[model samples]
Target: MEWKFVRLLSIGQIRPGMKLGKRIYNEEGLTLLAEGAELTVSIIRRLERLGIDILYIRDEVTDDIVLPEMVADETRREAVKQIRTVYRSMMNDKMGRMSYPHLGYSFRKMTESILDDLGSREDVLIMLGDIHTTDHYLYTHSFNVCLYTLTLGMAAGHSREDLFTLGMGSILHDIGKTRISPKVLLKPGRLTDEEFAEMKRHTELGFALLKDEPFVPLLAAHCAFQHHERLDGSGYPRGIRDGEIHDFAKWIAITDSYDAMTTNRVYRRGMLPHEAVDILYSGSCTQYDQRKLEVFRDKVALYPVGLTVRLSTGQTGVVTSVPPKTPNRPIVRVIEDEEGASVQPYEVDLSRHLSIMVSRIAEN
Candidate 1:
């Protein structure tokens, strides 16, 4: 029904039309859904009281979807964990003044290192098919923006200095949000004009904060200032049109918006990856740079490892690897049948098996 990252998922909230990922099941085949002590009617009522919706048991699943452990490196793994922690802290701090000193440099440098190998492709895909699902919301958006920016810069054949500049810009793009009021930031409803204006002031405020940083890059200031500026002058802080905003700034805005929309917000649920793409499609080249967005679709993996998704066969399965060039499709391991029938484990590659498609996206 919607998109949810594997990390925030609770077994107690399992529902129909949702898909399961490899992480859904543990080494012993017990799932988060099977963690609670009992599934009795009284227990269900207790779960509901606690804001839980449903529960699931590990069903029969295909095996090939799980990747061999060889590809995941320990150092990269540890770094990824740290990125998530910092991202959440920053998101919570967006309402007012907050301290997050090293995040920008760290995010920029780390992304640069990772993209070094993925850059220079015939195409500008910054991630491999096998590795691109980001779990944390804020940092993930930061990372996604940088990823797209870097790759686009490369495709446009910018120099190393320019590439690094793009990275810095993307990471700091939302720094202005640090000045918005808390209630308005997390309001579970649409923002009022006054509240929205308060939010808009963040762009100018974010720019002010970085104006004095001694070693900060120029685009970093622009990132905070111009990321929200639109090609048609519909963006905030200023009525800047096409020639006013830099190519790199525009790139970050497009990636940033797409990532933010597909992520879970307190007031609203995230759009499915495919759905997010469709929404972006309408604005591509108009609100966004068409070429860069297309390159983004190439690098970003919608069905990342350890996530559950639905199949066209009316079954649910977990995603393991990225499919070749087909970011829309991926390798999946079946876990359950349409009737919720128990089935054995098996793997299917959407790229190889064109007959099957990711008919819908279900949450973990």
Candidate 2:
């Protein structure tokens, strides 16, 4: 039977035979339970041991609520795996056991998989920073940048062929970092001017590596070369001015910055999606192409569904739906009062109440 609503409950409140309304993921983004899995005594104990205190459950009262997934779990996992494959192949080639042809083929296959999984979707407002493990940061960030770049390109009315090139470029744009020393890449503190200069060479290095490879276009190479270039010529490498940057490079720069800001790194905690968007907007024209950045704002979910938030009125709720016109102001299902007491659930459409702004992300 299809459940019409979903409810969030404490781990103690979950009983055996209750079906999971949403997939439960650990802090590392590993799935613990999939939707529709009927909880048993052991499963409940397992979740408790893992310190999970809250989850979405399918039940009679909350059966009317439905939470939409940002992307298919299978598709995201496959993309990450393929990205890992490509990175490893590149590493092998760097070690002089070259396989240019195989590497090129793998890049093409990964791009095609990306298209098949995400291209036909109506919207691409996904959570890009979900998979965050220190060791696999490169692979995870590459996949996210690729996804975000593809979405921005599509929004600009780019053709599929153009998106194919854009996607490939965005994924491999940071490949040159592999050549840098781990001492610099993994450093927790600020880098010295010398170390910073060395870090900046990734752009040139990436361009040189991919420039003449078979099946890789010159445009893709430029994407690696120029993604760092800013509109005012303040960026690294060539420091080229506004009109000199390639269209693909310009778009990738915006997505790269967005993903980088919203992702947790060893040095600092990640910003929320809306917070990152605000920073991007502040940098428009000087650090990014303002025209492209505008399109980016429209496509991303500033207040993504399933996020718990506190309103200015002191009510807390889970985001229910993003109104079409105002992506920032969403309809929230308020479940708690100002003092943290559980209350009767009700919907609050932020778009309707101009004074009720979202305060911050609330803990589940």
Candidate 3:
């Protein structure tokens, strides 16, 4: 089989004739453009409007590197569609208590599908940060959070039943945001103190929406309530501290914060995985649980495959693989020399070359 080389490129760097190396999906999870489709001026404009920041493009240097997907594309489409449905209903209803008869049954079924998909994988490292659309941030963010939280739950040796509850809570953790006004919710600048105060209300708002629902689990509702509450009692809605919060909420909090930081938003560009992890570590034992942070750091691909990075030795390469035990050290395939010249590509295993380091992400 012939292997295609693919490079991750920001949308601004992509040219009109460049072939898309990956399929583009809309907010509904329907295919907006199939893989190998040619980009055009109008399509590019539309994608920019949708707030898509990055895309995979065919390249000649990086070879035989295929990105991993934790769930089937069909499963993701259905999950996103379901999330959009439920969240939209909650956002549109003035009473905030629309009696959706299938709420519990539907979500439970979706959770099972996600778990089953996750079970089939041997190693799961989140690579979903590569593609994001700010307009659809809530829906995709919910789904991504669920995936990350469930992965952490499984790593922590949770039972299947426990996993189900965790998944539900993580997926709906931000349901309260549905009630916030779009003006404040999607603001492109730093929020004022008044706006942030209103934003903090999502926790209570989420709890109020989920607590009385017939099929929604009480623990799941609390997960929404307490996911923002820090270990140091600095979190809002109740100022709850460690042991005061449930274990499930704690797990959701770690993944929730990770996803929010790594994902692109209208207000700012997303941080790289390593950078986000650093911030998480900075808050360890104060804002976050210590042991759980270790588990999450190990599972993450700090430098994901296809990311262009610069080495301290002044070479440039795309990450080929991240070692499971040493996520910080990845195998990189160098394609350029220090002088910004193309070279005969070769691989460098950072774990073996302990003296060398990845300096930073290569500039466009």
Candidate 4:
């Protein structure tokens, strides 16, 4: 019988004869491993040297493993296309640039469709974990931030109309970046002081582009303007205090930072969901809204499905599911024992073990 279960394991966990269930790619758009290829120790070591973290492998023991996607692939593709259109149209010229009235209806229509689709789902955590075009990072990042903000809004019980507005603001929050010099914006290395200053102007530039448009709401424009503002008045352009910041801006701040940090750029790799949440928590109250940050924390998958983790009790397992009440604790399917011996697959509820904590994420 053919193996039906497929699990995403780190490169370190692969053994000879284990068949790849998915193709692997380098960040530069080259295929490194083909699907259905049996992994050998030498090939695995090459992947390690190349900085590959995880691989989908078909195994008899994990035949039932499944990882759920955050949104349908079709919907994401359409949204990205729409964003690219709006961006390209606006970047055509300074004076004769495409107007918002022309694009506002279509933009809202797309946002509504996205909301309609996401609203039908039961999962709260928004994971945009998919391979994307390295060249069109802005458009993809915009769509991701928009969806994430909408999910966070839903978790916070925003009304339907409110969700529509939030979605609109989020998708276009970084539109101003299109006006920035490509050299500084897409620089693979750290920015110089003046380049960094120029980069920070995206907030005001975006707001200026959208503020006068009749169809765009003032609230949406504010989201574009103040997304970088901090609770402790440390943010740029305005240096506004907590009370001075708008609600949607606060929400977008968290979403924007989270998405930016978790996406792979030319210079850095994407972080795991748990690791991203930890960074959000570290900046709570000082850099982000504390209450909103907590709401975000509870909604994300702390131990996302297919992630391998090591437990405090010296056990290692793959996270199978996240318990709603205790997101930090998940249902783990243990595959290795304390002595590092292969064991019969067994499930453990992490919440039940008061003393056991997730020590670290295991490299795939």
Where is the poorest 10-residue window by lDDT in model 1?
22-31
What CA RMSD would candidate 3 show? 2.4
Candidate 1 vs candidate 4, lDDT winner: 4
Candidate 4's residue-wise lDDT over 1-364, tens digit each?
1122457675667888899875664333234576678888898787666545556787676667665656665677688777878776776666745356666677777788889878988865765355433444677788888889999999999999899999989988998887888888778767999999999999999888788776677788889999999989999889998999999999999999988777766566677778888888898889998989888888787776767788888888887777766778888889898877878889888889778888987653
Ranking by lDDT: 3, 4, 2, 1
Compose the digit string of candidate 2's lDDT tens values, residues 245-266: 9989999999889888876665
Per-model TM against the reference:
0.65, 0.80, 0.93, 0.86
Q: For model 3, how does the per-residue alpha-carbon lDDT over 267-341 read when each residue is reduced to its tens digit?
A: 777787899999999999999999999999889989877888999999999988777667789999999999999
Between the candidate structures 2 and 4, which one is better when assessed by TM-score? 4
Instruction: Name the better of 3 and 4 by lDDT.
Output: 3
Among all windows of 10 consecutive residues in model 4, the one with the lowest summed lDDT is: 127-136
| Runs of candidate 2 exceeding 4 Å displacement | 1-67, 92-99, 188-190, 338-340, 352-355
RMSD to truth, every model: 7.7, 5.0, 2.4, 4.1
lDDT of 1 by residue, 298-331 (tens): 7566655546778989998777666547867878
lDDT (0 to 1) per candidate: 0.59, 0.76, 0.85, 0.78
For candidate 1, the per-residue lDDT at 278 reads 81
